[model samples]
Target chain A: MIMEKLKLNIKIFFEGAYLSYVGLFRWLSPSTYLATLIFSPLTQMLFFVLIGTYAQGTDKAYFYVIGNALMNAAMSGIYGVTMSIGGDRWDGTLPYLFGAPANRMTVFLGRAFMHILNGMIGVLTGLLWGWLLFHIDYSAANPWALLLTILVTTFSTSGLGLLMGCIGLITRNVMFVNNTVYFVLLVFSGANLDLATLPSWMRIVSNYLPLTRGIASARLIIAGHSLTEVLPLLIEEFGIGLFFALLGYSLFRWFEITAKKRGTLEVF
Target chain B: MSAIEVINLQREFQTTIGVFNRKKKIVPAVKGISFEIAGGELFGLLGPNGAGKTTSVKMLTTLLIPTGGTAKILGLDIVNDAEAVRPRIGFIFGGERGLYWRLNATDNLRYFASLYYLDPAVSKKRIPYLLEMVGLTDRADEKVEGYSRGMRQRLHIARALLHDPEVLFLDEPTMGLDPVGARELRQTVRNLQDEKKTILLTTHYMFEADALCQRVAVINKGEIVAMDTPSKLKDSVNDLSVVEIEVFGIPPETVEKIKTLSMVENVSVEDRDQLQLLLVHTSKGAEAIPLLISELNGLKLGKVTTREPTLEDAYVRLVGGE
Candidate 1:
């Protein structure tokens, strides 16, 4: 019986994940998809890379490349996952969702599952852009360690997305909040500036965030460092990601109860 | 056991007025209204716009937490056993909005079926059956955005029945459909009744309630004014007759003047394009018609006739023709 329940939960998780992701892009033409998931991120990366290389010199292009590449995870995790969750309210499907008998945890977390994968793809795509445009060297990198770093980073960022998605449930200004947080991560995740040159307080702030360790770990892995050398950072990054995901899940549950109580499940 | 039961159920919304020093006002939407439905009975809650019909339905469906009282669906308390209650009941708010517009009808059903935790094996068989049941089998693969309002409404029905819920709450299911579409939808509803599904349908159309419901509760201002079988409710106006006087451009003061007539019990107007239909309920019957025409002195008049009171006259009389 327990096995059957678990199997059913797993099925709900994946099916919800896939369907919601498909729902998010239902209006997208091939051009829109390319513009959103590909060209938009690519152009943003190029702008930041150009500014970084111009200020620090050409040799430091790898630093900017790795930093901006990982930002793609935040891009997908924050914007994509939030949209998947918030879409229920905008599309008037929230009531049916709330009315369903499905496990709340499964349905809530399933929202982030597809975005995690999408974020991973987005990060990988950014890295590909890095290689094609700037000739960044991946020859010395441990492929497995880098892959692990990307997964952790995307997972952590998606956790933040889940939290923002819950906030979207109550507030009409969700897109404004999403844009602000994305830019905040860009500044504070050490995506652009060198951590050492920054003030001590900013460095302290970076340590508590998701991508700080993941980005540092990715840089180390690419410079031919063994996985063991950066094992502590990877562990911390994974923990941070887990923390946000759980926190988001909690907020999601709270929002559901509160909306039902306040009779605002589909108010917006 | 009753398929659905309610006791003094209520819901109040708190809204703030004004920007500076905003004052919170508690507005009661469903004011402690109560009713029950027997298993396998087709029940209707008849009310006008803003009559708390939707709010009452929302609370019973576990979509809104009541401010007072309690409700049970299939013996499960709506508030406490909401999780268990959800699987046993389905609801359609009756519009194009509840569906995933981007998805094909088939995908929409599959997704909702997962939300209801239906086994894949069951949903696979059930989706096609429901699509056929609602007469959307041919358009099952088309995106809902491409569907007409009626088709979308049909898909809404299909989605709600994906789990084969024992009780269905349909709020204004045919609100915006054309006559033929509404008839088709009503037919589908009747078929569901034939299948022994307990249905609680809320609508403002009295004829609809008369034609479809075994029992209906006439609600106004968040309270049920009367609850009984449609025929019994209509029988409340049996001594009365409805004189529908078709007039062109009747003034508001003239309507108020006619309401003052000793023979008029209640007066309500229906706007039919260029003409206004004056539906006057009175025990005087045809005798009241000449008095009404005399009051309408200068207005251009059309077909003026008296007919037997219907469920609508009963409704207009009970609610005082708002």
Candidate 2:
């Protein structure tokens, strides 16, 4: 049964990647990419890289680029699921998904896996764009550990996305919910700046945040750290992913039946 | 065996806020409503908004957990054996939500078909057949987002029937379609009856119920107010048979006088013009028409129309309302 579920999850991943416009629109229209992913984090990252070159030193150039890379992946992971799921909630699309024959776990995992697939595409774009424009070197000596970092990063980010998706389900305000929560997480994530320079309390908060530990782990990958060196961070990052996935899966399962009983699915 | 049976079934929903804000207030959407829907029967639940028709359907379809009552499909408890019931049922809500907008009609069917564990060969073969069944064969390849309201409705119906479940629950099957589309959808529903799929059709449309349902339960305010065949419901109203007329020149006083006729039970002026009126239960409409014209004293009837007891009249009479 578990094997079959895993197989079904793969299919759902492909379905979400191929079926969702957020996944397919870029391929179909080509022009949709620049407006969606480009101006979003890519443009901001470029501006920050240029600013870091003039204001700070050469060290800050890599700092600006690596921070953008982590932020891009994090944003992809969080928004990929939240907005997609939020889109469903805004239009009350989750009910249609919930109305399917599969149980809640199947539905949540399938969609979450799909978001991971889409998020990878976004990660690819951010990495490639960063490399091309700023001539940044993303190559690592231990490519395997770097890949592992990206995997755990993807998990942690998508996990946060799952939690955000659940909030979208309950709040039914996709834009406000996504923007408000994403902005708050982005702040503590210190996605825009170096967290080492913050006050003691702020640094403490950033380092201990649900995504911070995971962000540090992902950054270790881009900077080409050994797996043994970052194993503890990897464990924490993977754990956060599992936590959000389980949290999201359970909460979504609960809200699903409620939506049906309350008849909110039809009203919207 | 009964297709659907509910015995004192109850469902309570608590509105809860964020993670720590688990305080809840229970709302009873279904108040222990009990009834049986027989197999191969096209049944209907008719009500206005918030009537609990959808709630009852969801519970029966295993989409909801009952709070205090028990509902069974083919003798299986919905809550305990929900997965079992879902396979035996085909469900559809009247909206564009179910089908993936970016995907073509075939893709949507294939997705839902896979969801039901339909074999790949069968999935590929059934797509066209379901599309043909809903009369969207030519439009099958087009993205559902581009489909018109009626076409999208047709595709949604195709998606519903893809699994070929024994019992089909359709909630407001034709809420937004144009008259032509509604008529087409009603026809498709009638054809489903011919196929002997036990169907529970809920709609605010009295005419749709009258035309399609073998047994209809009129639900209002989360309670079953009336239930029976359309004809039986009409009979329950104590229908004396009324004369309906639309005239351009008839005056209000004349309408009042028409009510005073020996056979006339009540005269109701319907349209803005006093001329368009309905004369109820005075004389059998056929015999009363000439008499009404005679009483008119050359008021010269403009548009005279008559009809047997209609579902609206029946509903109004039974519910003590309109």
Best by lDDT: 1
Please state the interface RMSD for every predicted structure, separated by commas: 0.9, 3.6
Q: Best candidate per DockQ, number? A: 1
lDDT by residue for model 2 (A1-268), tens: 8887666666554554445534223233556545655557788778778877888765556666656666655666676677566556554345446656654565565566655655556656666677788777767636677666666777777887878877777764655766766666566766556678777888876654455665566567667777798899889878878888888878777777666556555443
Each prediction's Cα lDDT score? 0.89, 0.71
Model 1 CA deviation exceeding 4 Å by range: A26-28
- Scoring only the second chain, what is candidate 1's TM-score? 0.98
- DockQ of candidate 2 relative to the true structure: 0.41
Kindly provide the TM-score of model 2 when superposed on the true structure, using C-alpha atoms: 0.84
In the predicted model 2, the residue pairs found to clash are A88-A93, B9-B69, B10-B69, B263-B282, B264-B282
